[model samples]
Target: MGRAGDVAVGVVFGGSRVDDGQIAARQFLLELWHRDQQRLARVLLFHRLPITLEEMALQISMARRSRLAFLSALIACWFGASAFTYQLALPGRKLVFPTDHYSHPDFKTEWWYYTGHLTSASGKPYGYQVTFFRFGLRDKQDVKSQPLFTDLYMAHFALSDIAAKKFTFRERIQRGIGDKAGAATDRYLVWNENWRVSGAGNDHRIVVSDRGTALDLNLKSRKAPALHGDNGHSQKGEGEGRASYYYSLTRLQTDGELTVAGKTEKVSGLSWMDHEFGSNQLRDDQVGWDWFSLQLDNNSEVMLYMMRRKDGSIDLHSSGTLIDKNGATKHLTKQDYRIEVRERWKSPKSGAHYPIKWRVAIPSESVELEITPAFAEQELITNRSTRVTYWEGAVQVAGTARGAPIKGKGYVEMTGYAGKLNI
Candidate 1:
């Protein structure tokens, strides 16, 4: 349904100005642009244009600098101004698996996020995060002259060596040139460079390798998917389009191999996966968010996110979801819970102060948690791709539920602390 039709037409009529390669290439850029993937759309467009062999070298040099300069300005124009043209995440959205697990081109932004805390056979603890993002540039039908696909694909992989108190992360961005990166729409598969995540049924595999760290894990969901908010229509703000279709597989049994410093070890643990998509989510007044995905020892999971305003108050739209052991979900509004910062840590690299310790409580549910980080420094400086600095780290949760002592591991994400999170 993409460039295949254009390719067939060009081949049947023989090569011309609108040959198969030209049509396909243009469509590729158009698709990216249409989806609001402006940087990649412009990068590939600059690279794919015809150039004489003599001038190719010069053009390449110029293109490199131009692309860099253009991308540097991306923070000002990241998601295109086509929010009205794209489909918004309104209420009453239905989510079908296999299809929804892949990519959503109609929406402006989508992400497949996985994070877990693992323990090696030797008793060493580890934490990891692998996420794939699809950013749409423009609508496909907008390309009138040539078939163009203007979408950008980005992925981030991180591993935390809790014992060593070290965290490593890598970020990548691709224009899908020559099939180097892409996401399958019919199935659960997303990849960039050598990193990939593929799934069938409730079983998923994550493979990521970079520098001296690698993670190869197989995750099988132990419970049904938990729909967040009103039937997965998660509201981020009071505006019409400030929402998203959000769901999570909060408890997945994980097992596989992880390589650190050239040493591979067998590991097993529980993972949490969050998939959300929509055209617009954060409102203009919202600056950032603090998100927690906790998997308690009691087989229960809690997903909470607080959207923070410039005045340091939690937005009214902040909410959460409680996934019971039976896989049933209960929505929690802003007033249902409280998050008190017990301690804060400042990052030396970014000079941003982030709360590393939190006192979290849901009085109605009788769940109280003291969230502490495995390490104080797990910040990700993603200047290469997303161009945002944020903290995503393994956390230890200790507290009580219904008067019963409980403890577990989870992940906490704090954004806008390093800088204003644009997307």
Candidate 2:
């Protein structure tokens, strides 16, 4: 559900009609729900298989096709296990809140995502994100009698040094089977050994230091609840149960040390955190999403996303948030935004082209700015969630703020651009 399909494509191939393209994409999505997104398929299932989707197709590249197929197998194993139970479809009518936050086991999956842009002691930029995903095996809470029957908690953390042109990444998968790795509710703690993101009281800390690389972050927010529109009913497509509960904590006064390569330095900047969960988040006709959360130089922030259909048009309800410095929030519906990919990168792995550079236009304020990622190799390949890979990287924001020189830091998450993210 990450590819909001807002970015433009140089050429829409798969089908002559947008509907045809969407149908194909949706088919690809549905098939993957069992194998890829659900984490039902594991590495052992295909470790013996040598097929890597490296061919070229008129639709997407062979790498994507193979990835989609491989991902489907992985999700099937992860979700179809005996540990989780699901509600399948449920009513999503309430505004999602923190108290409402946690694993929606009834649903296929959920993730708590945290990303920050920080500056090192000597004036260097370092960015990183820590995401903890919980997948309910059978939608049934784990029974205490069984030792191996437990849901899976997958953690992915990465560090990007903008000027260094390199990345520090690590991924871990632990079956909540026991206490090797687990998430707690009464207090904030999710960890597996030395790597953990924990907090209680009013403060949060993400500590994951391994093999000399780590992200020791301290988070404090300046804004209240920066919620997504429809009263937290984030519609993905016009269909039954095609929505999610999405919310964000924008503009966190970030202070911590980003350790990468081999050094740890004190850093301070702005950080953003997003927590979203729901049952059946994808529509039959939707492909993916293009999500961007930016902290503008004027002290105001914009959180915008485009949910795209297979047919190339946008889902009118794939909205965003506009928060002012004073902590007030504005609902930005589908009409007030226009985000496009001005440049692209053809990943050597999948050979599927991804829009790496973008020009975002917000007509309401007569604003036009270019947003681009600091690196294109931020695609992560994790076995815990499946072998599916996607782009999640730090971005450099540059443009004029009301005819003045202003720059900022943020992150751009592009999905479906390379192919369906499966997750």
Candidate 3:
């Protein structure tokens, strides 16, 4: 992709060389041209040449150029790679009330991801996950098409239905770098023709569907936004830049219809949302993670996460929060939580082991909860866009808090264990 984008960037550069001294074009368009050429020059230029130790210094000095004037050339080198597809960058320190919210672009990747718990009118439980991801290709030169309306968006929508002691999962992928297919501007909604998740004010709507399974739903949020880490400075690892602007709508009131096996039924349940975007989302040594969002009987919500590293150690930055039924939030650190796997179930389809039973303990308040899947076959298979498989389902909750029978409903995300997440 870099070679292709470089060829395109090169042509723009060639054209700019012809009009070299035109001040009006040089200041704006020519600069955009130079910035883009410098980006492509980093990769394509070095590939065809040999650099001496002194040339290395010159290459390092490229950062003195405007393209990377904001950050160091060494660090900016990674951002210039082919990994960048599309980008929206903003500079700031903290999130303002209601303003620092919503999707952020400057970060490497951002997604409006939704996975939920549902029950059909016939009393059958179901699960669904629909995600829209945004990636930053920092340099304007990363544009693959001068056609402006070219495709720049990617989406994945999936559905899982559990009934009659069986489960079914379906997924769809969307590629619409077009303005109409996946247009995003002014904080309004955007989608690839159909699979959509967007909002204006307090009302939001999302829809993802196909023949075997579908989601035609309306979600009205009750709880306000909950920021993760220090005002959206959620860290991914010990590294300085390995963090993201992350937050979640712990609980959203869901009333919608789901279709399974050519049958559509009206359903209502609780949905959870996570919105995060950053550059280089994962750490080099981080293996995968187990994330859970449980709504307790006490109207409190507990979100726990454990980042598995290659050395089998847990990353301390892998922590979540406690949101009361009233929507107030309390942050949780390394000392307050523990997740113990009691039994493992291997997916017959993917041949991966997933801990079916978990003993979740939060030592801060001396609480222990046992999470059992509503059924053993809650595993999901995506035929559309995910290009991956995992288990996402409703679970029966049983636990004791202060020796009282406490019941809760929640969702758990088991990744990396199945296979390293593509992201």
RMSD of each: 7.4, 13.7, 10.1
lDDT of 2 by residue, 211-315 (tens): 888878888867666767666666676776676667787777889886666777889888888877666777767777878888887888888888777888888
Score candidate 1 by TM-score against the native. 0.82
* Tens-place lDDT digits, model 1, residues 186-234: 5677888788898997679999998878999999999978899999899
Best TM-score among the predictions, by candidate number: 1
RMSD of 2: 13.7
Ranking of models by lDDT: 1, 2, 3
lDDT of each: 0.78, 0.64, 0.62
Model with the higher TM-score, candidate 2 or 3: 2
Model 3: how far residue 96 lies from native, Å: 4.7
> Candidate 2: minimum summed lDDT over ten consecutive residues — where?
6-15
lDDT of 1 at 63: 56
Q: How close is candidate 2 to the true structure, as a TM-score?
A: 0.74
Per-residue CA lDDT of candidate 3, range 206-292, in tens? 877766677887777788878777776677777656777777887778988888777889999888887776765577788777888
